[model samples]
Target: MSKATVYFGIILLLAVVIYFSLGSNFHNSTTSDLNFGTFSMKIPRYWKKIEFDGIDSYIGGITNETDSLTFDYGWYSYNLSYENREKQLFATDTINGKIALITKPKEVGNGTLGIYIEEAYKKNRFNFLGKNILDEQIVFEIFKSIRFKDSDTTLNSKSFGFTDKITPYSGRSLFYTHCASCHHRNKNLFGPAFASINELDFKKWIIDTTNLGLTGMAKFGIRYHQKAFKKLLMDNDIEKLIEYSKVST
Candidate 1:
């Protein structure tokens, strides 16, 4: 109860407050914060994006999504099928975060080999007109859209949709059924690299190529692969394609 003791206690309490208030600073920075393109986000400071072999590439930071955090997650990939290389993928997990639920192909090793995207919202909450947020439940939207130059791809081709469930085989089946007629899995037979695309571009690409409900391409996409193309494909699918495109021969 002495004055000296009271003063010391105040100092201790102040220090504690300062430390706790710094909780958020401890937060992990999302990939967007970095300059890395929308393709391989969450890219680390240790790594850099470069045109390695004329394709989207990352070198450094945690590579494998499943592998324990270590050096740069190898290389994250973009669906550039024409570019022949090894298993390059997005290091989804943090150099320090939870173990990613989705484990990539063993060919990709244990690292979070998929692109980490939370679905482009129709309207971002905190960022209403570019605002910020502390409220988790108050959902915002992203009034954003990606359109492609070519008109042969679809949204399904984009990072699978927000949460698609198309497996590799099914995706391939769907692609072959709908895309192979015009495109080739391993070469630029019809269009560009099916792999080099980012999810947003991929989706937009699908819409452009297929023509959804309009004219040109959709005739087949809507006729046969419409249901699965729209439903089964999701953002994760984009992640898969990003990787799949790279392994192409």
Candidate 2:
């Protein structure tokens, strides 16, 4: 019952509220969960699906349609299977169409659902929350995986869909929030930059470094095992991160 103790309690309560309100990746999302191969990346609630018209390109988007941000997700025998499912995507779009050419096999790591993100007047960049109309669109090709609902057997299922949390984080934003503490834009501070490490060990280093503290630096990550961020971000985030680094470096 001391004054100092009471103030500390209030501060702790505010911190928790901010963490839940702003920090949670599900704060303003709308989906069940994104599927990374067999792994599940939880999506927010209340989000719907996007419906494409079999055309490669999209046009005539205004800056007021919140509903337009959500699109119908489907994949046929070649690319139109899930005419209803919903999911998140990191992509780029043109007036013509998407651009995902999966050359390598799809795995839990390093899987890119290449797609073009079209916006109002072609603003191809990450805008955090889905801004006005196409200014914040996220569309992509399907990752071939096994699903319990789609496949005849439970062996595997390839989930396909669009997402409300479609836009990926910008490189500049990622650097400030995620890497600024221990890393710089050009050189490595605690560990290394995007150009320093390989893709395979990047995630592992993030986990083990936080757990065991590899090298001289201790575990200083912002979102390695966060319940919200972990559920929201896919390996593609890392790839986007790498792409971000190339620009910075």
Candidate 3:
């Protein structure tokens, strides 16, 4: 072969290699990892973070034109009646040993759909929702890439919990994390309605549930939620939680 032909062939091979390498990066460049102090997840760069309101008001969420992902460190409950259950396609699986549920409308390109994850081992939960998201595999890949920070140091040190920076938003997360399992804002659950408590005694109840300041059924909360009163909460955190409870309903 002529040297000129040999040079041209080598250059052509290098061009092919470079093209493939750049193509791989271009695909990856469309997504980036979003950090939320305790965990991180891969999402499209076009997705913008927003705070949710109302009952889910404490949740930190992100969304684009068609898809949304919301998550928080706490308990989340989802229920569907038997008839409606038959109308949907749903499956349960595990993520890092934690149970997860992915639900979609019966037919593709149909109704609302979501993924609910219960991270029992870590006392945290997260979920994603999309409307008419034609590609379930793409959403699954995003959920699969979620990475939880290996330690609690960041959760404790940062604004992850109720703190001086507490807002109605963060307070809702705190309530869901610690209080929602037992207490409800309006009607009674395992505990009395938050609406019944006056401000002064409510502060006392949160600060020292085992103390003499509490009486009757209110004291019952202590045995079930000792860690809430004892662990990680500051005076301001308690105050913020109290503020949230009043407006929570």
Candidate 4:
């Protein structure tokens, strides 16, 4: 055989070996089943799980070397006025037996291309995180794989191993749903941490401050009154939240 033909045969053998090795690796990797209170999903073994803090209904992220997917669940009254501007609607489709609105940005040249899926359920948002790594078809497949778990089997405050000090778990849920995105227990995101407030009558101060706008903070009482403030401002709810804050801080 010619020298060139011999070299080609050797290269083809190496390529076939590499392909089968990769395929075998993928097939042998173990997958993890995640139960996120409201739902459950299977994650590929190659993805690394990222830990999240706070008492969100469900919060989790799984990342591969070049791709990731993160999901968060919270209760927010739907408001058409508060929709994001940077994202443009890409398509609407049924995913996991629920109506989903898929959106993407007009520009995706920054190495990151996010495809957001908003379900009509009004409480959960699933973000497919990657940099042109996961195509639309793959995202849809992942979305379809999501399975809503039975409410009875959902994880609760006790499952998280919280002590009695963080009782009235509803308040923790409320804080997580409404406040956690912007505020952390000890650190700050869009707003100051809950620990920074040093009010003698913190409950009343919380009510007043949240109701009245100050500096960079909008009057949440007015803005989210119908959506969340009314429920959060209830005497019992506020009391529970204050108690939780005291112990958590």
Candidate 5:
């Protein structure tokens, strides 16, 4: 072969290799749905799903080389009132038709920042930790793609593990609003399961007016939520909740 023709062929071969390499990288990093039985969310296929055991309140999440998306349960009643609220960046966005509260720290550049989604679904919160705020658009896209299964539908393979399929019942709303974050009907979360709790003790723990000086779990429950329980529950309401739990199963 002529020298010019051989050089041209070498250049063509290198170009083809580079093109395929880039294409493979793009395909491996593309987004896909990550299923969690009751819910599914869109995430980059390159990210690894990590199950957190007990790192503070974090339950589980997915992570990559420098980015992570952790999850935890939170209440809507906890309002945002930080001391340096003026310095930080806060914005409201919509997720699946629900309002989501987004917050970030007072960092200038894209360096070791995080996104906190405290409110949107009233029941759960998501934290996206990373180094670049500019790349946060992916997290918002993932959040927007989250879809929850219908209450009546039966879960396959993996499920939320609520007892008896956890089909909708009279006490469901109350449980979801007040107790679901930390307590489940059958599984233990931050607190003991409803099925494992004593009715009388549970009532006493809720109505903690006289148990201010107690210790252990009772004290922790009463002291931490003294104001909340006082504002949320009355004698009649507590009775109704107790009755609901008994028949919910």
Candidate 6:
């Protein structure tokens, strides 16, 4: 064969080798099925799973040179009122035979989507971060794969427990059910401890500071409501929480 012909054949061989190499990597990448008592999802193999103790949730992610992607599934319950609906994506759809509310991620600004699913008294929120890594379409595909396990066969079969229940009753119970996940009586998990702040400051912190986009706290007021708080706790309960804090500190 002529010199040009030989060079062309060599180039073609290189292209073929590169294609199969990439194909092999893609094929070998494993996908993991994650079962979080409330729901299950299939995650790409590249992502590494991270487990949190004492919390019924799963967080996993993979990072690269240019971008990163993370997935988080946690138990959360909320009633979407008109005001709440306005801030969301203004859309609703069914995933795995359950109605799910779609919310665009305002924090990431990378087109990440959040799927909120409610079943009986159990609710869960799935958050996809890093839109640069996984676009909206891919995110939806991953989210649509989520399946709610049978109620009787869930990981937490013990009455769905505190994470799923919305008991706004005594402040002590309220603290345990909600605040305890991120905070302890005297130590800090995700945020500061209650023992550090006085009762007045603690009440003010929950009512205003917690939702003010503070350094450590996110805006929780948007998801939880005062009406629900009242339904869950009485005036006496609030006082009790304050008194308890004083004694515990």
Candidate models: Cα lDDT each: 0.34, 0.36, 0.59, 0.50, 0.55, 0.50
Judged by whole-model lDDT over C-alpha atoms, candidate 3 comes out at 0.59
- Pick the TM-score winner: 3
Q: Residue 229: error of model 2 in Å? A: 6.1
Tens-digit lDDT string for candidate 6 (1-249): 899999999999999999999999887666667665666667666544455443566665444334455556567433333223322342344444444555553323444345455442245555444543335554555656667664222111111111212222334544543455465667765656667767665544444334434343334442243433545555566676666555554
- lDDT per residue (tens digit) for residues 1-249 in model 3: 999999999999999999999999998899888876666778778877776553742367777767665555455534222214544666544443333455666777675466565553355556656667677666766765565665222122111121222122245555555565577778798887777767776666656654653443454654434445656566776776778778854
lDDT of 1: 0.34
What lDDT tens digits, residue by residue, belong to model 4 across residues 150-241?
A: 22222222212212121222455545545565666678767667667554444544454444444324564334433455444566766665
TM-score of each model, paired residue for residue: 0.29, 0.26, 0.49, 0.38, 0.40, 0.39
Winner by TM-score between candidate 6 and candidate 5: 5
The candidate that achieves the highest lDDT relative to the unseen native structure: 3
Better of 1 and 4 by TM-score: 4
lDDT, candidate 5, 1-249, per-residue tens? 999999999999999999999999898779877876545678887777777664444356777767676655334322334314544455443334333344544554344333344432436554544444456656656655655443212211121121212122224444554565567777788887777777777666777568556453564475566556656666666675677666654
Weakest ten-residue segment in model 4 by summed lDDT: 155-164
Q: Give the TM-score of candidate 6.
A: 0.39
TM match of model 5 to true structure: 0.40
> Candidate 1 on 167-186: residue-level lDDT in tens?
32334433543455566666
RMSD (CA, angstroms), candidate 3 = 15.7
Model 5 residue runs over 4 Å out of place are 1-25, 53-58, 74-80, 106-137, 150-249
Q: How many steric overlaps does candidate 1 have? A: 61
What's model 4's lDDT at 140? 46
TM-score pick, better of 1 and 2: 1
